[model samples]
Target: MSSNTILSLVTPTISSPGVGSGLDVNGIITKLMAIESIPMRNLQKQQSGLQNEISALGQLTSSLSTFQTAMQGLTTAQLQA
Candidate 1:
């Protein structure tokens, strides 16, 4: 068999007679599209996680502000007594 024939058998991108060389351009494109979408899906998950963390931080900040105000009130009352 010619080297071209062997290469076609080994690689899917080449065309061969009788046996298909597995070179399906459309299938390859579809696989690549699937691979590209994976990262985008991961980023969406990450963004959701980040939003949750931001919400938690906001709650913590509000709690800290309330605590500080309470402390200031106590200090002022002590000073007046």
Candidate 2:
């Protein structure tokens, strides 16, 4: 018995987009990606703002605690007067 082998060569083709389509595909994609990320950016800004508010609240609470301590001592001294 005899076997015959055949060899075939295939060439790969690359397609360049926006070549003849006259479309700014790259620019559009860039803008679309930016648009898609808007909500995340907004959420990040909101998170930062909330963090700042929380920090301010903590500072205010500490100040109020200190003031309360001072007022208690003054009240006790007056009570003994």
Candidate 3:
């Protein structure tokens, strides 16, 4: 093969940023990141909501357990009377 042909294949030609590359790479990436964040934000919101629900359920269970213990004590006292 000729040196000129080898050089042509090896050398990269420089063009203006968005000229040869038709799409706006920076703008496309920015738009894609924005689109991608929507689902992430929604998932975070759902996770926070689920955490709150779990905390509330835990509190409710604790309160019910306390109430049962109190009732059992009352029953024991009544049986001894």
Candidate 4:
């Protein structure tokens, strides 16, 4: 292969980023996204906590309903005694 053609093949493309500005823009954006998503991560944790609380409340409600039914059955039996 010709020397000129081989050099052109190995050279960096003009369209590559940070060619002129010399700034690591992709790295900067990645760090910025991590910082920007902090609130979203916190909100996701809060949502999981709330779902756990709701599940506990549902369990409590179910237990209370079962107790009420048992109590009514006992009361009916006493009335027929």
Per-model C-alpha RMSD: 7.9, 6.5, 5.1, 6.1
Off by over 4 Å in 4: 1-22, 76-81
The TM-score of candidate 4 is: 0.63
Give each model a TM-score. Answer: 0.53, 0.69, 0.58, 0.63
Each model's total of backbone clashes: 1, 0, 0, 0
Q: Pick the candidate with the highest TM-score.
A: 2
Model 3 lDDT, full chain set: 0.91
Provide the overall lDDT of each model, using Cα atoms, as 2-decimal numbers: 0.87, 0.86, 0.91, 0.92
> Please, what are the lDDT tens digits per residue for candidate 3 over residues 1-81?
999999999999967777667878888889999998999999999999999999999999999999988887786669788
Give Cα distance to truth, residue 67, candidate 2, Å: 0.2
Order of all candidates by lDDT, from best down to worst?
Answer: 4, 3, 1, 2
**Between candidates 2 and 3, which one is better according to lDDT?**
3
- Ordering by TM-score: 2, 4, 3, 1
The residue-level lDDT of candidate 1 at 55 comes to 100
Better by lDDT, candidate 3 or 1: 3
